[model samples]
Target: MGIYKILKTAILSLFFIVTVFSCKPKKAQNENLLLSKKNQLKKAFRYPNYLNKNYILGKFDYMNSNNFVIVPKDLSNKKIYIRKEVLVAFLKMQTAAKEDGISFKIISGTRSFAHQKRIWDYKWNSKYKDLPPLERVQKILLFSAMPTTSRHHWGTDIDLNNLTNSYFTKGKGLNEYNWLLKNASKFGFYQPYASKKEGRTGYEEEKWHWSYKPLSQLYLKYYNEHISIEDITGFDGSKYSKNLQIINKYVHGINSELK
Candidate 1:
């Protein structure tokens, strides 16, 4: 009887030891995975600095009415388009502007990927080639992108007011721009890039660009950390060879005269 009790106690002790040993490695691995996820989140939320080369201008693309907000008056024959969510925010902006006695209009929004390619080719082949590479890059960055790399493609960004009259210049008193800076956020809008700091951003300051804050903020967070220029420009054209050729021919070659 004594021997049986002693043997039972020994077996129970061995079982407890085996269970603990089996669990330790799994617990350690789980802790490591959680730590890795935490780090990724931290990186995503950091404030963006202009100096970051990743701060390339986002590409724009033309989307159908379903993706855009159409202002009835602005739709005059032309299909007026802006990001669906942005259009809603713009409506809010318009209401706020009305209260403040300021008028706001969307001068431009959403360019098709093909259209962007054309603008890029025109700028690159035209007078841009005469300038230094860095300068050329800067110039192009102002109004265009290197084919397929524009945020406007997402249909969530827009330029307010006419480019000619409401050009984004530094230190220009914000009489009009200021109204947006103060009120846009209330409508869930924000300027992703501003002109005050040139040393950091290779592109020119564009006060006119406003993003629907909720989406823009999320995009900014993801883009700042994970996206790369290669992802924007590298598309398999063969899948849509004809469309690609069209983009290459008409859109890219449209401004050949300037080149």
Candidate 2:
């Protein structure tokens, strides 16, 4: 072959090889970028109530995520889970209460669906078992919640120093109660179930139950919008949820200040 033609052929082959290799990496890089975005979208959809029902229904495990923190021993009678933001506010409130010479403990915090179910089942098989189903449920509802319907599931409500209403009626309990009534709201907390004499429905007066409104209020909004009586199954007497207007008279029944 002529020298010029031979050199021309070599140059053409070199250009072809360089072009093919360069095109391959560009194609591969494009594919990798697309895959990365898809994975990111999946992760984004996983958070902030993915199913909208899971978190509110107590299906998610806050213990397994950074979204919750353990309640400190001094603040609670037992190790309990609470939302991180709620804990921060409570600590501030605790300090303020201490300065006023009043003190309290957290008797209960987050309760998962399974944990609540155990409570419900125990009561279901208690002496009330002999009573009619509706009556039995009503009796339980006086102070207890029906599993998924509980605000405790949200990690934003805590049962305070005492459980009995009489405890907060006078003496030290009364002092503590008065303090909370006067100052708890400054920390984004509020009593959920107030005295029936005030015309509030749902559970009986529980002076100890305080909710972190900033977060629980949002969760409550989600629960009302996403949850229905049909979703409140897996327990005895669940069929009566609709008849009892559990969503309205119960879930929606809160201190008007909370609304």
Candidate 3:
């Protein structure tokens, strides 16, 4: 080939390669941005009614995800129900644990708003009497207050148990818990308020509280953004209380990490 033609062809080839490579990254970046935008939009408006009479704790909103499968009434020794995606992941985790002689079980899944209220009243009247009303409300806000705010109201959170005991406490370490820590993310699960991160969450470290990965991310984002003092009050307040004000300060001012 002529020298001029050879140089021209090499330049064109290089230009084509560079253009294609550059375009690929741009395409990927656009896709990522689009996905992030979608997530944000979903988070902005996806608030569940924690006080709805029909709200069932531990029961999956099966309509929300196509991957959900009904747990066999017989196989689930307990009446606990979970999202199909969560069940699949849990079963897989169980199978993997058995290989190492570990067994896993579900102790608590969902709770009705009424049930939550009862617990709240019991706890408040029995254990938190010494706390100022405002402080008590602030503390419960970190977790759930019956008929007002509860992740368990969403049916995506689960309280798992070791084979020996279901109630969670310090020194109740089990291989299943470790396995979940390492592998639950693969199936879309995470301990949202891990004991290690208690300071940030303002809640007790719950080793057994695992959320379905996908929905939890959405809920966390929503919980961060939508459940403002205003929103919580709107849900169930007869009058403004000091506790509500404290909750607002933390939720709106400090814990504003929602994406």
Best by lDDT: 2
RMSD of each: 11.5, 11.9, 9.2
Query: How many clashing residue pairs, candidate 2?
Result: 0
Predicted candidate 1 versus true structure: per-residue lDDT over 151-238, tens digit per residue: 6655667777645424533334356687876767777776655543433232345677776766655554455455443345533222
User: How many residue pairs clash in all the candidates, one count each?
Assistant: 17, 0, 6
lDDT of 3 at 192: 59
lDDT of each: 0.57, 0.89, 0.58
Ranking by TM-score: 2, 1, 3
| Regions more than 4 Å wrong, model 2 | 1-51
- TM-scores of the models, in the order given: 0.59, 0.80, 0.58
- lDDT at 66 for candidate 1? 50
What shift in Å separates residue 37 of candidate 1 from its native position after superposition? 10
